[model samples]
Target: MLFPASGHTKAHVLHYYAQIAPVMLPHVAGRPASFVRAPEGPEGESWIAKNPPPGVPDWVPLVPVEHRDGVTEQVVVDSTAALAAMVNLGAYEVHVPQWTAAGGRDAHDRLVLDLDPGPGADLVVCCRVAERLRQLLDEDGLMACPVVSGSKGLHLYAPVEAVSGRGASAYAKGLAERMTVEHPRLVVASMAKLERRGRVLIDWSQNASAKTTAAPYTVRLREGSPGVAAPVTWDEVAACRAPSDLAFTPEAVVERAAERGDLLAGLLGEGVRGRVP
Candidate 1:
């Protein structure tokens, strides 16, 4: 099995991406994605040469790299318009972030919901939670996707325009509290570690770029192979019963998605309500 990536060398970091991204790029069809090399990242061309990813083209600009409490993140982002630029650059390379932080981007005000089934959560039950989350967002017309944590949980993502006048923090906090209030066992927003032990911790902290969450497609050090970390539709998400049980690769996710179709699409229309405030 693949060992957690050694953070020792920029080359080692780039090597894995060079080897892995080709298999993963197809799933990220609508986002602007790029890689950043540590230490050297903020300097200049040194970062690019030290960790030159396999397929990224020539046009992508060198971004400032970020290192967080637990992981080292290359300051790359994926977005609808950015994805187009990445293709224009050269290689649509992938990355495995050791520490991730978010802040400078316009991603603020966007909502993120972490659907965690506490320790020893039954896969069947967790899948049900995933299904329910999908429904809730769908009913509200919010954009959301499902992701499997390297450990025993899953996460749901919802995007709101932070620019809509509501700060990302307020919008995310209110929604998290509301979910816990409405579905006590399904979502928990408290910081008490004890409460999170056996329940799915609904985390909405990613509203700030400074807050870090695991990105899809990258393997968690202790976790095994990182599977297709792309966005899935509500139908696909609703049907999932513990996606962790299955092996993931960008190719596999794409193949599966084609056969099954995405479930979250119709939910992102205008007029999503209940602002953070």
Candidate 2:
């Protein structure tokens, strides 16, 4: 079992990824991936793997990524088989940078802001913050999509013209800082935990070139229940009254995909893309 508390087995994880591959692959396909693996399950020892794990087949695609220390060839989940291979290796979560390998390491085409609720705050609070953020992005001529993170938070994604990773990071950081100034009681941009109490943290740092956010449609290994980081609509975001309202299971996400199709499909099209300024 990959999650002893939730009674989820490795087969369950593989099935979810395979089923979500069609919509999920477009967001992650050309991006270098990092995996959070728990061979002993969620409660057991888990590690992040940037490079391909031992025993991965030769057919899996590997792309070289250069870090400050050195270069490592990271796995790219470009196909269903490639994704399943990662799951079979005990990966419960897949993370990828905002930039893609095909666009080069510095070329960032997406902007992501992770809305994290601190002490005394919850998903309800996050929903309020997300609405304000949507307005801010709208003023900036960018349209943002909300995704329930499946682990006590929400993520906002927007498609922008290809810019340097540093450029994207700067824009996001500025927006986050502005939110804190305009709405002190509702938002906090600082990373310090103490300052986060009673407010939501606008985590703009995820846009950094080296950082990764949980890919959309990936399962989270939260205790008691496993949650899928599922895409949501603006109407649903406004309708979230409790944490459970936004929390989605893997099975539920698969059903949603079949019924509503990809809610964030606009991010993939060229016509909807915008610039940071």
Candidate-wise lDDT, in order: 0.47, 0.90
Q: RMSD of each candidate?
A: 8.6, 1.0
Q: Write model 2 residue lDDT over 1-277, tens digit each, in one string.
A: 7666667788888898999999999989999999988787777888988988998889999999999989989999999999998888887799999999989867888999999999999998999999999999999889899999989999999998898888998999999999999999989999999999999999998888999999998888776778889999999999999999998888899999999999889878888789987
Model 1, 37-152: lDDT tens digits are 22322122323321335554454434454435443323244333333333233322333221222334543434556666666555445557667666676666665566655445
Against the hidden reference, what TM-scores do the models get? Answer: 0.57, 0.98
- Looking at model 2, the pairs that clash are none
**Candidate 2, lDDT over the whole model:** 0.90
Name the top lDDT candidate.
2
State residue 8's C-alpha deviation in candidate 1, in Å: 20
